[model samples]
Target: MGLLLSSCVPTSGGLPPFVNPPASTPYGGEYANEILKLPVYPRSRTLDKREFGNGNSRVRFRVEGVNVRMIYNFFTDQIEDAGWGRNRLESEGQNRTWQGVYQRGIRLVRIRVQQEGNSDVYVLEVTFLQ
Candidate 1:
């Protein structure tokens, strides 16, 4: 069984919205913050991170012992609360994948969560677009 929650918020014109830190600080620490510029999920293990320069970057991490729905909600709520508007959200039960796109001014962020094989681990990827 699977549950999916999705929403879309209209974008507004003006200065970029201020990004508030997540209520519970992420476990990825400073490095994760520097790379993704967003709160890493608590207790997540970073698997890979890359910078494409010009303010474009991507980070991949593994979240263990948690369901896909929880992780997806965490990031979506956090992003919306931070003043970013959601442009799109989608989830597929069969593949166990969830994705959301949020934007604040010229900054765009894409977050994806997918189950890894048959393991209980889920991999989350966050991409920051310039």
Candidate 2:
């Protein structure tokens, strides 16, 4: 009878796995105050409409770390794309580092995940640079 009950119980592995920091993964310290504050989730991400290009009010996602990257589409100037950035597993400690002067226009920034591990999601507001 005990064996029957054990088999009937569901396992935790079948459910959504929770993330464990440090050992399993390490999210670098937050930088770029503007991008650090954006609304993001496990499967979906978002941003306010007045943070990026101008202070006139517009939705723009703010993000950081070594997991995702926002690519800019030179043509349409809209972030209709999102995916991974760069891999930190092989580049020692510089895989997720990105540096550049973002263009002054409406460009589609796509978020891309580079590493193979748990994803960290959070929500924040877009504060324009005044």
Candidate 3:
């Protein structure tokens, strides 16, 4: 009877696993004076947007139905096309995270993205010189 009851119970792993940082991760607050025309994926949603000191800005959003590599490529290419040079790119495969930066002269932009383990959502945080 005990063995049967144990087997009947559902396991947490079978359900949706919550990532450490919640799904709606924001780099800045809800509103900003300046709007950063960031490259958003097709199914991306802006969770939060805000501006910081000296015209700097940041945005946090989530992209759905896309792989980590695809998201990384799209954002990096978009940055380069916008005249920002690729400065650094670091990948932590074990942690399922990637950090990249772009620069053109004194203007700089940075992007940090992490894939929710075993999930279809990708959390992205972008900071740009305004």
Candidate 4:
């Protein structure tokens, strides 16, 4: 005989249960500042990023300067340059922002300063949307 709860049971590799709550308040200012203050990221920037670590994740950032390199997964953070090559990004410049999306698996450290210029000081903001 077939089990009555078969339809109600969750199978292996099946989709996870869904639950939705009301939209929350925006996170900015001091609260966001404190999050950036966490031991996850290095020296904070104008738009400090709140890190969320799990396995390995790639952070998406919008930079204004050229020759920009990110310091991802430092020391215990596992921030390395290996995944970057594998997940090479495609950039489409607009205004002062170099827009692109990165995967969720690597901890981003800092934006490596290559050649300094008048506009080299970019407003970096890394958001965790997952």
The candidate, 1 or 4, that scores higher on lDDT is 1
My TM-score estimates for the predictions, one after another, are: 0.31, 0.20, 0.31, 0.24
Candidate 1 residue lDDT tens string, 4-120 = 222223226332346444476656577655544433354433322122123333222322311112222332221122222443344455345545666634556655556543344
lDDT of 4 at 93: 45
Per-residue lDDT over 19-110 for candidate 3, one digit per residue giving the tens place of the 0 to 100 score: 34346536455433122333335432322212211333323232231111222233232211122244334445534554565653454555
Ranking by lDDT: 1, 3, 4, 2
Regions of model 3 farther than 4 Å from truth? 1-94, 104-106
- Report the Cα lDDT for residue 6, model 3: 80
Of the two candidates 3 and 4, the one with more favorable TM-score, higher being better, is 3
| Residue 26 lDDT in candidate 3 | 62
Task: Give candidate 1 misplaced runs (Cα > 4 Å).
Answer: 1-94
Which candidate would rank higher by lDDT, 3 or 4? 3
Candidate 1 at 26: error in angstroms? Answer: 22
Per residue, candidate 4 scores C-alpha lDDT tens digits across 35-79 of: 444344333254322332343344433332112234444343322
The candidate, 1 or 3, that scores higher on TM-score is 1
lDDT of 3: 0.39
Which residue pairs of candidate 1 clash?
A: none
lDDT of 4: 0.37
Compared with the true structure, what per-residue lDDT tens digits does model 2 show for residues 14-62?
5324533335324434545545675443434333222333432233443
Q: What is the TM-score ranking, best to worst?
A: 1, 3, 4, 2
